[model samples]
Target: YIDFYNNNRIHSALGYLTPAEYYQQSILQNVA
Candidate 1:
């Protein structure tokens, strides 16, 4: 369930991205 929430579910607050997706994007942005 935790994995589903973080990696599979899409969140409106995160611009329709899953938490994992959002985190990855943030990390890329910070690195660049």
Candidate 2:
């Protein structure tokens, strides 16, 4: 059972990346 909004979810508003991925990318971009 998965909570679609909380897990295994990809957001189109974030360019189709998962929330975790989107956050990680933002951090990397800021650091670089």
Candidate 3:
């Protein structure tokens, strides 16, 4: 359930991205 919430569910507040996707994008942006 937790995994599905973070990795599969899309969130409008995060621009329709899953929480995991949003976090990964932010990490990559910071690394670059």
RMSD of 3: 0.5
Ranking by TM-score: 1, 3, 2
Candidate 2 per-residue lDDT over residues 1-32, each given as its tens digit: 44566346888999998777788899999999
Clashes of 1: 0
TM-score-best of 2 and 3: 3
Model 2 misplacement above 4 A: 1-7
Extract clashing residue pairs from model 1. Answer: none
Q: Assess the local accuracy of residue 13 in candidate 3 as a C-alpha lDDT between 0 and 100.
A: 97
Q: Candidate 1 lDDT, tens digit per residue, 1-32?
A: 89977999989999999999999999999999
Candidate 3 C-alpha lDDT tens digits along 1-32: 99988999999999999999999999999999
Q: Please give the lDDT score for candidate 1.
A: 0.95
**Candidates 1 and 3, the one with greater lDDT:** 3
Segments in model 3 whose C-alpha atoms lie over 4 Å from true places: none
Rate residue 3 of model 3 by lDDT.
Answer: 94
TM-score of each: 0.89, 0.74, 0.88
Top candidate when judged by lDDT against the true structure = 3
Candidate 1 — worst ten consecutive residues by lDDT sum?
A: 1-10
Candidate 2 residue pairs that clash = none
